[model samples]
Structure formats: C-alpha cells, structure tokens
Target: MTDDQTLADTTPPAAHESPAGGVFGDPTAAPLQPPTVRRQWSIADILAEARVPERYARVCLRADLEADHERILTELRTLIDVEGNIIEAEDASLGEETNTARAHRLNDELEQIKADMAKATWWPRFRGMTSDEFAVFNKEHYPKKDGASLEDYNNQLVAATMHEPQVTPDEVAALRKKLGMKAMSNLIVKATEVNTQGGVDVPKSPSSLQNLTRQ
Candidate 1:
C-alpha cells in the first residue's frame, strides 16, 4: 500500500460523522466522491495479518516508491488543511466563534494533528511484509488506482476538501476578461466622462468593463 493510503488507515471511523462545509464552501457545490476507509494498523498488526515472508515485502514496498516517488514525497510535505480555515464544520454550526477567530484556532489544531501523526511508524516498516501477504492485504485495502499507502489516502482527503475546482479552458478565458487578470491591463473608460482626469479615488465603472474589453 502507498503511504497516504497507509496513513489513512490510522484514522478510525468516527462513531457518527457528518459533512462539515469548510473553506471551499458547500460540499454540495463541487461534489467529488469520497475516499473509502482503510483501517489504520500498527507495524505488528500489519505483520500478524499478512502471511508474506520478509524479502518479497521489501520488493513490493520499493517498487511502489519508485513509481511515483517525488510526487508522493512532495504531497507529504504539503499541508492537507486549507490555509487559516480549519474548523471542519459550517459557519452556522460554529455557533459563536467569529470567522477570524475560527480560522486562527483551526490552524492550531491542524498543525498539531500533523505533527503527532508524523511520529507514527506505519510507512518505514511496510518494506518488511512478504509480497504474497502484501498482495492479499493490499487487495483488501489499497483499492485506489495509484494508492499504495495510507498517506496517499490522506492526501486525497486533503485534495477533496481544499483543492479548488478547475475552470474549463473556455471558462478561464471568460473569467480573465471579467477580473482584469489578463496579459495587458487597460484603463477603464466611462462614456459620461466622469472625472476625466483619471482620478484613482472615483468608482470605476463595473458595468461597462465587459463591453469595453470586447471592443
């Protein structure tokens, strides 16, 4: 199993879990299917379950690392939670904490979970399981296409929660025109000639921008 997949195994199922809308807004808006659960097991737990001999386990582990080593390693260093906003619930559900306070406190909790999880020895010892046993264990657990460990699964969770949805190529072009996030910025012109001196303080015409850009 991959590290992220293996890492996810550490998280036991919550007795009663519910969707908590976080930084990315409503979960319903950009719905991606959820990752399947794989129970987290300790080193001994893995050994007891798998019947593989030592040599083959090492080979299986090494091969997985070589396939996507850099990307996998980089993901480990990347923070899983969104910047600032860490509370795993909707704003209304938060009850009293203001948005600013919620962000600050959630940041602390996310950092601590990551720090403690780092010390767990799930990945380093996977190399010891027999390939025969690994195949059996892996089939039952690491089902994601490229998944080889729990860490990969954790990264997937992070991706689902925080990764922004992609805009299509056409949509990107349209948004660029609207936001003025383009190669060449232009000074907006108003037909009424409001403050013709180009005073920065005056309100720029939002309604006219699209028409002017298309021209």
Candidate 2:
C-alpha cells in the first residue's frame, strides 16, 4: 500500500559477498576458492626443453704439423721482409733465385703447411647431457673415488660428461696422446663451460639497416 513498503517488497536482497572471493550468497556461507592457475607452454619453451646445447673442440693430432705450420709462418715473414728490401734496392736476385720468386715459393710452402695442419685438426662436437644421463656416465666412465668429497664428486661428474659422441675409444686415446694431459684438461674445461654456461657466443647485430634487411 505505501510507496516505501512496495519498493522494499520488490527490491532484491543485498549480496553478502567476500571482496576477495567475489562470491555472492548468504553471509554465513563459505567463500569460493580461486581456480588453479596452470603453466602454458609456448613453441619456444617446448623446443627449449627438447633441445640439447652443443659444443665443439678442435684438436690437432700431429704436433709435427703444428711445428711445421709455425716454421713456415716464420719463414714466410722473413721472406716478405727480404722481398720488400729487394724491391726497394731494385735487386733482381737473391742467391740462385730472385726474391720475388723465392717469396712466391715460400708462400706456396706456407699454404701447403696450412692445409696439412687443417687436415690434422679434428673438430669434435659434444652435447650436454641430462642429469640422469651424466650420473650414469660418471658411474661407468669415471667412478667417484672412495671417501670422495662433494667437490671431487662434482669434478668427476664434469669430467665424465665431456664425451665426443662421434669419436671411438681408439680415436680418443690418440687424441689424448697428441693433446697431452694439460691440453686435454683444457679441452675438457671448454666442453664443461659450453655444457654448463651456454657458451655459444651471441652473434653481433647488423651494423646497418641494409645488412639487416639482406639477412
């Protein structure tokens, strides 16, 4: 009958909702729990999980080849100096042959030595192993010493995991012989760095817009 009474009768009840829960109901009712959040995987994330980081080590099997390379380089530098003097002095001859001719001969020799050295160098690729894989590898290849400390165990783990998948045991033995203990240790360090530290160098950005577009 009264306007105020009529309005009150038609009006809906006020919601006794929790601000945090955003749930509407009786004040005495429990608040609704939030829905669980889940991680969404992108293509990049999936690929990253599946991808294995790789590293390469270059080892020369012939110390003699390295020596020859250095010797030829020295000879080439000396020949170049003499060649410059010959041109300045206008001398056509040096011993049995002209400096220009001898310089060319030395250049040929240097090139050949470089080729030989390149042939002797081996590029071995290594991939990082998963923790489970590394554990098994360590047990098989480099077992922990008795009463080993944590540091020693970790060191052995690293040493065991530096594996060149392409090379055979005989090839590895040959490499060790050529590299010696010091160089072999250094190579292992490099492999470990790549595996643990993501040692692939980030390529430099293009210097100009043209280069970027070309790429």
Candidate 3:
C-alpha cells in the first residue's frame, strides 16, 4: 500500500459512542430532533386564534345606590363591631340609634343583601367574622368612655409596653385582634361591591363578552 493508504487502513474507526445511550446509540438511531421553543402567552395572540370576532356589552350601575353603598357598608361594619360590647354612655352620642337598634338595622340590611345579592360571592365575607372578633375590634377602636383616636390608642399602648423587653401575650393578642378588625373592614367594603344587583341599576354585562344571541 502507498503511505497515505496504509495510514487510512490502519487507523481505528471513531468510537461508536452516543451521548444519549441505549437504543439511541445504535448506528441506525434516528436523528436528534431540535427542542421545541414554547412561545409566551399573549392576549393579542389569543384574540388572533379566535374563530369569531368578539363583541362587547355595557353595564351601568345606579348612581344613587353607588353613592349610598359606602354609608350602608360603614353602618353594617359598626353594627357587627359593637354587637355586645359595653359602650360608654358618652360614646353612644354619635347617633340616636342604639347599638341594639344599629344591630337590628344591620340584620335587616343583611337579609336584604341575601335576598338581592349573590350569596357565594358576597355573603361569606362578613359572615365569617365571629362575635368575639367583632367585640375585640369595637373595643380596640372605641374604648369605653375614652375619646382617644386610634393613633393615640396605639401610642399609649406602645408607651405602656416600652419598659418591657418583649410583647406580653395579652399585648400580642390585642394587636392581632386589632389587625383582624382592620382586615375585616377591607373585606366587608369589597364584598359590598360584588354584585350589580346590589345596586339600583339593572344587572348588565361588561362592554366586552358580547352576547351572541343579542347580535
């Protein structure tokens, strides 16, 4: 053999090794397919894939009900809060309505809500609060015969605890109850806005999601 031919004939073949072993290493193995690139979800892409053009509907809430709902919500929250607490004779000066009267009104309003609104969406928010939680909240905010603002109450509480190295169990309990009440207020406010039927206006669909039958 010539020098180049001799070198070619004597050289070992490259190892028939495959990074992907098992059946993949076989000489007759299929070619490695490229990995798929998943496209990110996009609202515009979703719209483009639709078989039909989208339509829109408009809903209008009653202006007067929208305006008054806040007052109603506030009253309900207060009623839940002060249901069985010993309110000082002085703190009772806010309105002619006694705590009993206020509570009665709240019950009436809740009955009205149950009658008019979506129970699954709205009722659970306020109903979850226990009587003790409401009482603690009312006590924390409206102390018996005390004209202290919430900030003042906090400041006094902090000052009282300043000498201590860590919060006492009672202090911790009080703080947690105060936070719970604040959280309940937020939840109640949001629940008050859940259903279109709660408003004086007729329930209507959004400007989007047009009804196919209507068109």
> On residues 1-215, what C-alpha lDDT tens digit does candidate 2 reach at each position?
11111211222246444554233223454645545986787999876866556767676666576677777677656655644652323654456576567668777887887787778776666677765675576676543465333333333433444566554455544555455543454455554554455533443332343255667
Candidate 1, overall lDDT?
0.33
Q: Is candidate 1 or candidate 2 better by TM-score?
A: 2
TM-score rank, highest first? 2, 3, 1
Say which candidate scores most in TM-score: 2
The candidate with the higher lDDT, 1 or 3, is 3
List the candidate 3 regions with Cα displacement exceeding 4 Å: 1-49, 52-58, 82-101, 110-215
Worst 10 residues of 3 by lDDT: 52-61
How many clashing residue pairs, candidate 2?
Answer: 0
Query: Between which residue pairs do clashes occur in model 3?
Result: 57-206, 57-207
Ranking by lDDT: 2, 3, 1
lDDT of 1 by residue, 1-215 (tens): 21322223223245333354433233355544445986788999966864321110011212233334444334433423555333343545536655446455555555654454444312211112234543454465445665343433222222222213422334433433443211101111110011112222333333335356778
Instruction: Give lDDT per model, in order.
Output: 0.33, 0.54, 0.38
Model 3 Cα displacement at 111 (Å)? 5.3
- TM-scores for every predicted model: 0.18, 0.52, 0.22
Tens digits of lDDT, candidate 3, 1-215: 11111211223347556554443334455745645986785999865763311111111222233334556667656555356552433466765768677667766775665444332222222111233543464467434554323433332333222222333435633544444333333322332222111222333333233344468
